[model samples]
Target: MKIIAISGGSGSGKTTAAKQLQQFLGNDDCKILSQDNYYHDHSDKFSGDGSVNFDHPDAIDFHLMAQHLKLLSENKAVEVPIYDFVTHTRKKETIPFKPTKFIIVDGILILSQEILRPHFDFAIFIDIAEETRYSRRLKRDVEERGRHPEGVKIQFDSFVKPMHEMFVQPSRVFATHIAYDNNSLANLFEDLKKDFF
Candidate 1:
């Protein structure tokens, strides 16, 4: 199996890129695991004013995610956790994930973690301007995540931007390729299809 990581700051197009890759490679052949699903269950509030730091690397259960990735790499099946952003907790059940020809793990912190970094055969960092990222993030949070605009803006200003600078942006150095635009990301996938297939 070919394991790839698509990582970037929130709303920097990492999830979109992963979905595009899955479409390009075919869903039967490509599988995606999102790091968001591994968020540690917390009863405390996750708002901008809350004490919990969701942007931090400690927010996810990396060890479990790493184990799941390893199993997928070895053609083994695993139960991937299901996290609820609304309730800030993990679901009682997990989604069964089977092995596939391509495993695409997308997350902001995937490349930042030393343990997870070595698991990826290829790494992609979606590079976007902070303004664009913030704009996209604001829309996504408000529309998809049911977040208030004011809270989203406060979080972006407080944690998201700073964490991106501290962890996500720095992780770019570890990526095999950097995608600055959607076209480039598509081209990269086309090139990989030729190389892998």
Candidate 2:
């Protein structure tokens, strides 16, 4: 199995890029695992102040994710967790998944960790301007995550941008490809075909 990772800052189009690639690779041959699903359940520790630093790598159960990835690579089935973005916690249920010809892991911080980085055969970083990313994030958060616009802006300024600069941005050096914008996905698709096919 070939493991591919799509990593970028929040709202930088990682999911969009990953879905495009997955479609190109064919649904039957590719299995997608999102790092978002591995978010540690912090609902209990939730403060009314809204100071949760979710963008930090510490928020993820990387050890479990890496273990599951290894198991999948060995042709073993593993149970993947389900996370609730609104509640900021994991659900009790899990879905069983098996390895396939292509494994696409999508998340902002997948490439930021030393252990997870080495497991990827191909890594992509979607680069976007901060203003554009912030705009996209604002829309998505308000629409999907039930967040207020002002709260989104505050969180972005406080945690998201800092975490990206500290961990996500530097991790770009490890990516095999850098996509400047979503328009570049077609070219990236061809490049991936050449590399993987």
Q: In model 2, what lDDT does residue 122 have?
A: 91
Q: Write the per-residue lDDT of candidate 2 for residues 24-104, one digit (tens) a residue.
A: 999999989999899999898765344788899999999999999999989999999998878887999999998899999
**Candidate 1 deviates by what RMSD?**
1.3
Which 10 consecutive residues of model 2 have the lowest summed lDDT? Answer: 45-54
Cα error of candidate 2 at position 187, Å: 1.0
How high is the lDDT of residue 47 in model 2?
54
List where candidate 2 sits over 4 angstroms from the true fold.
47-49
List model 1 lDDT by residue over 1-197, tens digit each. Answer: 99999998888999989999999999999999999999999756665343466889999999999998888878999999998877788999999999999999999999999989879999999999999999999898788877788888888888898999999999999999999998999899988889898
